[model samples]
Target: MAVTDLNPSDNDQSFRCTGALTIGRAGSTQRELDAMPDGMTIDLAGVDRMDTVGAWLIHRTQRDRGAHIVGESAAVKALLEQVAAADHPVQVRPDLRPAPTRALAELGTWTVEVGQTLFGLLGFFGATLVGFGNVIRRPKRFRMNAVVSSFDAVGVRALGIIGLMSFLIGVVIGQQGAVQLQQFGAEVYTINLIGRLTVRELGPLMTAIMVAGRSGSAFAAQIGTMKITEEIDAMRTIGVSPVEALVVPRMLATVLMMPLLSFFSMLTAIIGGGVFCWVSLKITPATYAMRISEVVPLHDLDVGLIKSLVFGFIIALGGCFQGMLVEGNSEEVGRRTTNAVVQSIFMVIVLDAVFAVFFSSIGWL
Candidate 1:
């Protein structure tokens, strides 16, 4: 095939092609076309094996000036059709709203379902206690290892974090109190404020929050994973009650550890408070000790310990309950673990409030 150029005038230029415009040859053709005058027509009658790039160049030339193709080949026509189609825009509509009333109704239904589930859990706990009592009478099918493992996990593992947090809390309380009391020339009384607050409220509350974040989430994830794998069912098939094997031991461990952990936290917080007082307020250790001794009563310590124990029980129970409810899926395990931490923290705060109200009403505060 031959390539020929026809100049209709000094300005009117056109090119005639008579060969395949393959990818390799298209680049040379493009350079030749580029050298032509701006308004030029290219005829593709003799061209063969037209591709997307050649079609695009033709379309672009037609857009810039004009082109006349004498050949009506199906491939060329199809490529031109595609280029024409590409120039049009597509419209899309997006749906952004979900039905609000339907969502509210579903939420209400879920709340009722959760309430019923809690009721069933309480019933199950009662029955497990009865079964435990009967089993104790005969002493059969009991695993000591599980109990010991749980105790170590929930108790020993939680001690360090609880101690550290409590100490920091004490320092914060002491520093804050010292700042306020310094205005009244009562900087020495900061120690009294720290001791009283730590022993009565902050100690138990902080300890409980720490445990919820640490051990409570651990319990939920462990049990929830077991549930997902149907290990709880396997345990039941082997004549082992899941509650006896799992929940009871955890509950016992938490109940025993919480008060002890709270005590450690309280001590650390007081030590922190002491350091803050000595450094910030320039109060002597003797004066701080005397103030603490005068302000903190034995009953206040008792109340805090009691609150810690209660918070521990709540945390353990919430963790186990959420874990047991896990529905044998990865998402469910994650959801339940989150639920355990949130529920445990909420319960701890609510119980703390209740205790505060009771103590205040009875003149303990």
Candidate 2:
């Protein structure tokens, strides 16, 4: 590289820059340029090669010192123009907003997302009903094998855990109810408390929660993987309805199993409460059974069965809906699976409240 003064004066001085003007000599070149006064002429006619770094340095010197660039080839002129065009102010710091404003914006976004999801779920449910209708019209299209497989998976495999959970919950309820009743010398009514609570609420509710966490997540993960793998698309290509082949069978299995599981949960819970009474309250099994039969109404059992059926429907709907919505990579399978469980459990609780209000209004409570 070489620099020579062409015409020197207190104002309007000129200098010629030659050789390769690039990153290698950018530091020295910048220092040399800084020594020159502003409003000078920079001659690039002798520059053999000028890259982006060189252009940036020259452009900066020209802007800061009011230097005029002159005498450049086409390529150098274009490169300099591009570098100059790219210069602009850019914001570096993050934009901060007031806390309340940020919170309101987040709330609005959440509300919109929830509305969209709800709309999509409703559409999916309608498609499921259409699939069910088609199967009903053509009985042979029903997949009995898939339904049986789902039954074994969702119902039979779940019995041990459901029973254990129910037993523990019953023991807790019995122990706590006894403690409270003992304060009023009404320990004998512990049977009524346990029997009524188990049959009317806890048994079916707990079973639904367990099913949402277990079978619901499984449904979403399985179907989501299928969606990601394009298996659902393949089914459609082969003239198979995904809803009929995949979703309906699983939903039917869940709906059929819920009432049975709820009943099993109820009996196990009652037995657990009875066991606790026998051990701690000096009550015999025979007396416990007699009291349970006398105090717990048949209507209470009906309430549990009804709730179980609805809960089963909602759980299957949420799982299958989330699964059908899956797209993109394998990570979507995990996200949809979690969404299935959360949506199912949340919907179940909301519907449970609705049912309670409805039943109470109708004098069934």
Candidate 3:
């Protein structure tokens, strides 16, 4: 590349660039052009060829020094105009909202999402109720095979873990209670504590938690996978309700098995506590049995079974709701499964609190 400066008189100058002012031809006219006398006009008519770099240089010199282009080709002129328009830097403004305003905006958004989720869950529950009514009217449509499969999956397959967990919990509770009571020469009260708590609270609470984590998560995963594969859609198109076919069986199985599991959990826990007492406190097994019978109220067992039934319903509802919410993909299956378990466990605890308050107020304790 080459640039030649012209001066015919003092305080008047013009520059001419020539011979292919293009990148990779070994030179640029940028420095020579920028170093020219102030207000020097540039002539590009002599240039053999031009590229983006040459156009940008010409555009920049013209923009800064008011250089007059003499005989630039139309293509070069258009390129210069485009480069000039795009070269200016953009400025970004920082956020200026007050802290309280931003916080309130986030809170409002969260409230809206929560409302939508609750509304969706309600719709699913209503659909399930409709399906239930239809099945009641047409008993032949009820799927006993699916119900039995769900029972085997969630109830029979889950007993070992549930029983082990409750028994260990009872042992820990009895041992700790015995130590504390022994300090007051009241070790006999350990039996009372274990019997009442296991019968009225721990039995249902622990069993429900186990069921939620196991069955509820599975429900979300199963339905979510089916949804991703479009099986649910096929059912809908064929005039078969997916809820009736998939959800009802699981719900019925849960309702049927939860109370039975809770009852078994209660018995195992009582035995665990009794064994611990017999070993650690030198209390005979016969005496522990007598103490359990004397201390545990029949109403406590009734309350626990009732709570288990409600907990089963809530767990099934949570699982089905989240499963149906899955719109697409395997990632959503895992996400909805996690949400189902967490939501089921949360609802279980909340219901337990409500029951405690209700039973207390009604003098059922």
Best of the candidates, lDDT? 2
Evaluated against the true structure, the overall lDDT of model 2 is 0.93
lDDT per residue (tens digit) for residues 139-235 in model 3: 9989999999999988999899988998998999899999999999999899999999999999999999999999999998899888999999999
Question: Lowest lDDT 10-mer window, candidate 3?
Answer: 25-34
Model 2 residue 190 CA deviation in Å? 0.7
Q: Mind giving the per-residue lDDT tens digits that candidate 1 earns over 39-136?
A: 66677788777777777777776777565655647888888879867866465875545789779978999999879867966875685577567557
Indicate which candidate wins on TM-score: 2
Runs of candidate 2 exceeding 4 Å displacement: 1-68, 72-83
Is 1 or 3 the stronger prediction by TM-score? 3
- Across residues 156-239, which tens digit of lDDT does each residue of candidate 2 receive? 999999999999888899999999999999999999999999999999999999999999999999999999999999999999
Q: How many backbone collisions does model 3 have?
A: 0
- Looking at model 3, residue 324 earns an lDDT score of 86
Greater TM-score among 1 and 2 belongs to 2
Q: Which stretches of candidate 3 lie over 4 Å from their true place?
A: 1-102
